[model samples]
Target chain A: MDTNTPLAQTDPVISDEEFSRFCEFFYRKTGILFDTQKKYFAERRITDRMHKLGCATFRNYFAAVRFEASGEEMQHLVNQMTVNETYFFREDYQLKALVDGILPDLAARRNNGKPIRIWSVPCSSGEEPYSLAIYILENWADADRHDIEILASDIDSAILAAAAAGVYGERSLQRLSPDLIRRYFTKQRDRSYRISNDIRDSIDFSRGNVVDPQFMRQFRAVDVIFCRNMLIYFDDQSRRETIEAMYDCMSPGGYICLGHSESMSRISSLFRPRKYADSIVYQKPFE
Target chain B: MALVRRAAAQIAEDQPSGDLVDGQERWVADLASADASIRRRAAHDLSQMPDAVPMLCAHLANERSLSVRSIILTGLIVNKSPAVVTGLLPFLGSEDANLRNGAIEALQHMPDEVAPHVVSMLADEDSDVRIFAVNVLAALPHPMVPEWLLQVVLHDPHVNVCAAAQDALVEAGEPDVIPALEALADRFPGVAFIQFAVDAAIRRIRGG
Candidate 1:
C-alpha cells in the first residue's frame, strides 16, 4: 500500500493476453477500437489506474473494473480514458458555413411553425453549442424570427456537469476574440470566467452516448447535428452504426456535420454530400 | 543504428573515449545515490548534456524518485535526438503526474533537429504523442508540415489529434492545401470544425 515503492518493486508490465482482454472489454462497452499498435498507450493508462487503486497487476485491475459493485470505478475509468479538449469558436469556419450557408437553406425550406432544433453530441463542456448560439445571435438577422433549440449532449457525466456549471479557464478561451470574450463571458474572482446566462440558458444539456441506438432514438426531428471530431474514436462498425442513428433521428432534408477528418462516404451512403461556397456538409435525402 | 554509431564515433574521435565513459558512469551512479540532494543535482547537471540523453532516458524506467525522474526528464527535453522522443514514449501515461507532464513537455519542445521524428510520431499509438507532434509541427517551418497536418486532420482516430492538426493547418496551411481541404469537407459533410479549419487555412494562405 506504500505509494513510495520503487519502480522495480512494482510490476508495470501488461502481457499481450491481458492487453487483449482489456481491448475486448473496452470495445464491447464503447464500440471504439483499441488495436495492437496502441498496446503501449493502453498498457500505460491501465497501469496508471492500477497503481492508483493499489492493484498490483493488470489482471487485478481488470477484475475490479469488471466487478466493481457500484460501477463508479468504471465510470471513472471511462472518464480518464476519454479525451475531451475543446474550446469556443473551435473550427470557426464550420460555424460560418452553418450560419452563412446551411441556415438560410433550411429556413427557406421550412413549413409550418416548427422550431429549428440543433444538437451538439459530445458537446464537451458546452463551448461548442454555446458557440453556435453566440454565432446565430451575432450574425443571423433571422434569429429572433424562428423558434430555435440547441441541445448539447455527452457520454461523460463529469464534463456534462462542467457544461452545466458553465465556468471556464483561460485555456478554453484561446480561440475567442477579445470582442466576443468581453461581450459574452463575465470575469470571475478566481480568474476563471463564466459564460453569460443568455448563452448558457440557450442550450439544453444532457448525458448521452451516440453508440446506444435506444439513447439516440429519444430525439426526433434534429434539424442539424454538430458531432465534430468524435467519430474518429469509433471503429468502422461503430462509426457506421452512429452515422445510421444520426441519419434516422434527423428530419428529412436535415443536415449533419462531422469532424473534418471524418468521411461519411466510408461510413454510410445515407447522407448526400453537398458543397457550399466555403464548406462541404451532408444532408438527409428528402423522402 | 547507423546514425548513433556515427554520432558515437564522432564523439570518440573528438575526445578521450575512456574519459567520456568514466564521466557517464559517475553521473549514472550519482543519479541513484542515496543522498536526495546528490541525486537531484546529478539529474539537473546530466540533463544539460545532449550526449547524455540516451542514458538518462534508459535510467528513467528503473528510476523511482519522482524528483529524480523529473530532473532526468528535463535533461531529455534538451536532447534533440530522435531517440530521446522514443525513450520518452512509455511515460506518456505515468502514474506520477510530474513524470507524465515532464515526458510530454520534453517531446513537445524538441528542436527542429528532431522534426522528422515528430512527423513519424504523428502516427504514434499514444494520442499524447500525436498531440505533442502536432504542437511541434506548429512551430516547425518544414515544407512537409502543412500537408502532413492536413492528412492527420483528415484521418487520425482521436479527436484531440484531429483538433491539433486542424489548429496547425490553420497556422501554416497554403493555397495548395485548399483543394484537399475542400475534398475533406465533402468527405466529412456535417463536421463544422473540419470545414472551418480548412476555410481558415485557405483564407490565411490567400492572405484573407
Candidate 2:
C-alpha cells in the first residue's frame, strides 16, 4: 500500500492489478518511465479509490480511475506526477542578469529600434514567461511603446492555464515583495491574488512542443530566448539538435539563458559566455 | 495576501508623488515604532525598484497581507539573497496560510538557507502547513527530507487537506507512522476512500 517502498520483488509489494493502473494512468498522461519499483507507493495512492469504489483490491481501483479519468483527470495526474515547483521569479539571478546587465547591452545593438521578441521555451504554468514580462518591464520601462514581445509556451496545458490566469495563491508569493504584491496583484480573496494586468498583458501564452519542428517553426528571431531547465531532461543528441535549432531561431547577436547549474560551455561553440564583471551571460556569436 | 495588495495599490496610485523614495530609507533606518500600515505602505513602495531586498526582508517577520508579503518575497527571489531567509524561517509556524506559502516559496527560491526551516515546518500544529511541508520536503534530495517524510501524515479538520497529506505520506513511505495513520483512519473512519491507505500504511509499518 505504501508506494514509496519498493514493491518487494519476492513478496510482491503491490498487486499487479494496481501497478497496471498506475503505469497506465501516469504513462498515458506524462509519458514518464515508471518501473515496478514505484508500485508500492503508486498502488498505495490509488488503492484508497478502490476502497471507496467498494472494490477491495488494487485491480478494481485501477479499472475505476482508468474508466472515470477524463481529459482533466489526465491533466491532474500529469500535474501531480511532474515536479512543477515554480515560484514568482524562479530563475531570479538569471532574470536580474538579463534585465539589469544583459538587456541594456542588447538594447545598444538594435539600431533599427524594432521590438525584441522573446520566447520562453517550456514555460511551465506561465510563471516563467510572466517573469520575463516583469523582467523586460523593469528594464525597458519604455518598452510599452516598443515592439518588445514575450511568448511563453509549454506542453502541459494545466500549468499553461495557471500561467495564463495569473491567479496565484498566497503561497506563490513568498519571494515577491509587498510593494510588488500591492502594485501588481488584485485580491481575489483572503487567500488568493491575481497578478495585475500590467504583468499579465505583457505575455502571450500558447501551447507548444519544443521537440516538434512544426511547433518550433512558429517561433522566430528574438533578442533573448529563455529555455532554462528544460534542456537537461532530453538526451544529449536531442539537446544538441535542439540547441542548433534554437540558435537558428535566435537573432544574430541574440542571447540565451540556461538553467543555473547548466552551461553551453561544451554544448556548443556557436555561443560564448559574454563575460561581465557583475554576472556571466551568454550571447550568440556574430553569424 | 490579496487584501493587502489591493489596499497598497490604492495607496501607491493615490499617494501624492513626493521624495518618499528616501522616506523608505528613513523608515528603515529606525525600523521601529512604524505602524503596520506605514510599514506596509513603505514596503510596497520600495519593492518597485531593482534590488529592493533589504526593505522586503525588513517586513519578513511582520504581519502583512500575504499578497503584500509575497511581493517582498518576490523581490528577494529576484535578488537571490539567502540572508532574507534566516529571518523568514520562523514564519513556518505562523498560523497564516500566506505565511506558510511564503515560507514554502521562499524556501523554494533560497534552498541553501531555507531548507532547514522547511524541515521544521513538518512538525507544525496545522495539518495544512504540514501537508505543504511534506510536499516541500519530498521535493528535496537531502536525507533529512526522507526522514521528515516518515512523520508527514496528519489528521486534521479538512478532508481534502487530510487526503492531500495522505497522498504526500504515501509517496514518502512513512511506514513507522502507522499508529498515527490508523488513528486518523479510525477518527475519520467510514470515509472508505482513505481506509486502505491507512491499513496499508499500518501493514507496511508492521512489516506485514
- Tell me, what's the RMSD of every candidate? 29.1, 21.1
lDDT of 1 by residue, B1-208 (tens): 0000011122125433342233556777887888654575566567767777777887777776654665565456434466787677666646665566556555544545455565567778888767766765654434456667888877787766777777666543235667766766676777788778767666655655
Report every candidate's CA lDDT.
Answer: 0.69, 0.58
Q: Per-residue alpha-carbon lDDT of model 1 for A186-211, expressed as tens digits?
A: 99999999998877876788777887
Residues A1-287 of candidate 2: C-alpha lDDT, one tens digit per residue: 34355434333245454355367445532345467785444455444334345665443333344333122333344333445477778868777777666776767777786666777878887777766666566555445545667777788899888888998887677777888778778888577888887667667777867756556545556678888767656533346557755764567788888765456753444577875434556787663
Categorize the docking of model 2: incorrect
After best superposition, candidate 1 residue A245: deviation in angstroms?
Answer: 1.1
Model 2: residue A6 alpha-carbon error in angstroms: 14
How well docked is model 1, in DockQ terms?
Answer: 0.01
The regions of model 2 sitting more than 4 angstroms off are: A1-84, A139-146, A276-279, B1-208
Instruction: Please provide TM-scores, in order, for all candidate models, with all chains considered together.
Output: 0.44, 0.42
Worst window of 10 by summed lDDT in candidate 2 chain A = A66-75
